[model samples]
Target: MELESYRYIAIDGPIGAGKTSLAKRLASLWDAQVVLEQPEENPFLADFYRNAGQHAFQTQVFFLLQRIRQLQAPLDPALLEGRFVADFMLEKDMLFAGLTLAGEELALYETLYLQLRPQARLPDLVIHLQAAPEILQARIAERGVAIEEGISLDYLQRLSECYSQFFYHYEGAPVLTVNTEHLDPAHNDADLRTLLQHIEEMRGKRAFLNQGG
Candidate 1:
């Protein structure tokens, strides 16, 4: 895929959108280091998912700090010169914070986010994977992550909308949006090849790969 030209590539999407899978595949193909969001390390995630009203603030804050620490170095060329593939963009941290926080909590989160945003480096390219919320829900159910068990189809729908809006206006870097309801790159060789071609074909500020049903 001629990935050497780009130092860092970000694979982004809502939960169950196959971002982590694709990011790992791309990194492996290029023999590059991969940085992934460590949701499993978030001590408040399960409780927050089960009872968002009670734990949302802590959950969001924990993720914000984690993202900063994980991304600060590799994202900057002077600190880390090696190529890397990241499953989540540092800015997307605000997307989740917006969804789970509001009023005073959201205001505070935004304050912290803005203060730290500059330290995070922009990726050379961003691959945005999207799918129908129903498809996303089914995938989540199949994966059976106990904490995510509490994630409703309604939430997935809302989250999908949020992602769409975010990417629609996002111009920080080149974005290649892919409809993944029918694409599985991690396990299917042909699908991965098709996706790689899409990446190579990407042009302009925005591009799309929609495998119609």
Candidate 2:
């Protein structure tokens, strides 16, 4: 497929799902600009991951605000000159919000999000990555982030559910849902190429890239 045909590609997934690796590869192949969500920028992330109930609102709000700031910025030279690949989807913002915030906190966040909705370039295509909760947990352990060390399977399960629910109705753009339980796009070139082929052939509102299919 002609890379120029896809000016903006957004890759989204839960933690340890490998969105960043694929985004980097795609950006290099297309010579496109890359936008990565800086999860480390959330000062409350460590604490929130350890004790979500106590720090959930702060962590969620911090990420929401930071992502909005990044999204609102003008197209950089690389994007203006060529295509762009991003590791996060702005639409996923609400997934985290719903998972992390409570009644009053969520209401406040919704109001703020409405006011600061970004008006920048939108994705021509989105790749929503998925994996089994067990696989996600194992990957998290291998990476060994101190803050994430305490993350339980229960939490990951809930997070995966939230992501699934959010994307179930996502109609903002063309979506390609990839089940990565057995396929590792990061180290598997064949899997990546297969997905690229699917992206090129996609014409529907949603597409699924699964192992059996």
Backbone clashes in each candidate structure, one number apiece? 0, 0
Model 1 per-residue lDDT tens digits across residues 52-119? 88999999888888988888778776776677999999888888888888899999989988886755
Off by over 4 Å in 1: 1-3
Pairs clashing in candidate 1?
none
Residue lDDT tens for model 2, 90-207: 7788788888887999899888777777666677788899998999999999998787887889988998898888888888888899998877666788887887788888877799
Q: What's the TM-score of every candidate structure?
A: 0.95, 0.92
Candidate 2, 155: how far from true, in Å?
1.3
Best by TM-score: 1
Candidate models: Cα lDDT each = 0.87, 0.82
lDDT of 1 at 86: 93
Per-residue lDDT for 17 in model 2? 86
